[model samples]
Target: MKVIDTVLNVLWLLLCGIWMALGYFLAGIVCCIFIITIPFGIASFRIAGYVLWPFGRTTVERPDAGAPSCVGNVIWLVFAGWWLVLAHIATAIALAVTIIGIPFAWANLKLIPISLMPLGREVVSTDEKFGGR
Candidate 1:
């Protein structure tokens, strides 16, 4: 399973991951340029990492997150989130057109939510034990 995941991830990177990640990276840079939106910038960078290597990992909502995350998500949506979502959707469609790219397309679709609301999400490797460090 690990080997398969690695192979899929590699293919994903070649097909669409790099382009999606680049979109996130560019958004992060722009968000960081403004002092008030720095938090959103940080979130963009976090999602960038996830999009870069989505297989073998998952993103979960943070149990302790509260109003701040909600508010931040709104701001993110207004400023950059929509753009990322569009990019992910577009890439997903393009990848889905070919039989070989179906898995990568699904991965790209899975990323849309995080791209839209990056705040208060945590990425965890699927193979890691629940209580392990």
Candidate 2:
């Protein structure tokens, strides 16, 4: 990655990474406390990485070639994805209400489409995949 790309990715990872991790952590704790919910918790943990670094991730209709699929992924959407999407939507609405916050609100809204369907998305860098110049 170029210096600029590297720095931006780093900053993105930092800003959202911790928030994602915390969400997953709480989800995990909930699952652990109730053994029946462990599966859902684990699913949230998987999503946390994508949530944190969504900038580099791309969601596609199909997998690249061969990728693992899980039975719990759907459940994940039901339990966790909705919450994340709601949070972002609420944030977007709140920010849009203010002129100064319009930019931030736009950023939050940008996350919606991808956040809704994160499956099959690729997380890659310009140097690592098709993004290279």
Candidate 3:
């Protein structure tokens, strides 16, 4: 990751990433309680890691991921995703209130879509944009 991305990520982790990741972790735990929801649980955990230090990473649709992921995402959204989205929005509002936190607030808003539909997405390094992984 670039120096700027690293700095932004560290700041984000301090200001909002920890709380957002915790939200995802809690959602993952809930999803894991049932056998049928294990996939959603896994996806939630994956998203949790991405939320932790998000500045240098971006989410892309996985070409090989199929219908099951879509179905799981719907179930996830109905069950726990909405609450996480609300949390993100609330956090964004709080962060936006401070000048220093404005960038983090934007990052928080960027996470809402993934919070709502995490399946079928893979987090890749921004360096991949330059043909390197």
Candidate 4:
């Protein structure tokens, strides 16, 4: 399974991961420009890494996340999340056009929820037991 994930990740990176990660990177840079949004920028950067090599990992809700995260997520949804969602959806559609891209398309679709509400989440290896550190 690990070997398969590695192969798929390589293909994904070659085909679309770089581009998607770049989108997140740019978003991170923009968010970082404002001191108040540094946290969002950090989250964007983290998600960028996930986007870059997504195969063997998954995102899970952080147990300690609280009302602040919810508020931040709302702000994120208003300012940046909507566009990210659109980008993912667009990318998914484009990827879905090719037979080889179907899995990648599904991956992109899977990313939408996290992109929409990233503040309360953490990316973890699938090998982790329920996202424990």
Candidate 5:
């Protein structure tokens, strides 16, 4: 499974991961430019790494996340999250048109929620059970 993940990740990187990760990185940099949004910038950078090599990993909700996270996510959705969601959706649609790209398209769709609400989520290896943190 690890080897398969490696292969898929390499292919994904070649096909679209690099571009998606760059978009996240750009968003991070933009967010970091303002003093108030450093946390959102950090989340963007973290998600950028996940976008780069996503095959063997998954995102899980943090048990301790509370109302603050919800509020932050709402803010994110308004400012930047919607753009990321649209990018993922567009990428998915394009990938879905090719039979060989079906799995990648599915993966892109799976990423929408996390991209939309990155606050209070943790990225973990798929080997780790949710809440194992």
Candidate 6:
């Protein structure tokens, strides 16, 4: 089940494999230029662990706190976010071209929001989500 599989992944991320997660965090950090994109930058750092190890971490869509970082985040999306989205789209296309890569492509798509403006988003573990289910 997707739930079970996703939970397993959250556990892995809390471990010592943080370096692997840094790759995503670093990408996000690069986009944090100007004050507007700071939230996204912070968000990216927050989700780096999940991006690094999605299987062991869990992603749940949360309600946006209503214009949490609007101006800055918007500017960020216009600049670097679009490029990251474009890159992810390209990778998805390449993976979709092959049947075996569909899953990876699907997972990559999930990274969009966090890849864009990570501010106001929270990445939690399975245990935290289900109260230790």
The root-mean-square deviation over C-alpha atoms between each candidate and the true structure, in angstroms, is 1.7, 4.6, 1.3, 1.8, 1.8, 5.3
Q: Lowest summed lDDT over 10 consecutive residues: which window, candidate 1?
A: 124-133
Worst 10 residues of 2 by lDDT: 62-71
TM-score per prediction, in order, is: 0.93, 0.54, 0.94, 0.95, 0.95, 0.63
lDDT (Cα atoms) of all candidates against the true structure: 0.85, 0.58, 0.90, 0.94, 0.93, 0.63
Rank ordering of all candidates by TM-score, starting from the highest: 4, 5, 3, 1, 6, 2
Screening candidate 1 with a backbone cut-off below 3 angstroms (N, C-alpha, C), the clashing residue pairs are none
Per-residue CA lDDT of model 6 for 1-133, tens digit only, reads 5676656455434332244356556656774774755666676666666666676456665677557555656776776567767766776676677776676677768777766765555778766788866
Candidate 6's C-alpha runs over 4 A off are 1-23, 31-39, 61-66
Any idea what lDDT model 6 has?
0.63
Instruction: Tell me how candidate 4 scores on lDDT.
Output: 0.94
Which regions of candidate 5 deviate over 4 angstroms? 130-133
Maximum-TM-score candidate: 4
Model 6 TM-score relative to the real fold: 0.63
Give candidate 3 regions above 4 Å deviation.
none
lDDT, candidate 4, 85-129, per-residue tens: 999999999999999999899999999999999998999899894
Question: What lDDT is reached at residue 52 by model 5?
Answer: 95
Positional deviation of residue 74's Cα in model 4 after best superposition, in angstroms = 0.5
What would the per-residue lDDT of candidate 2 be over residues 30-101, giving only the tens digit for each residue? 766778766556545555665565554444444552344343445556766677788777766766887866
**Clashes in model 5: which pairs?**
none
Which is superior by lDDT, 2 or 5? 5
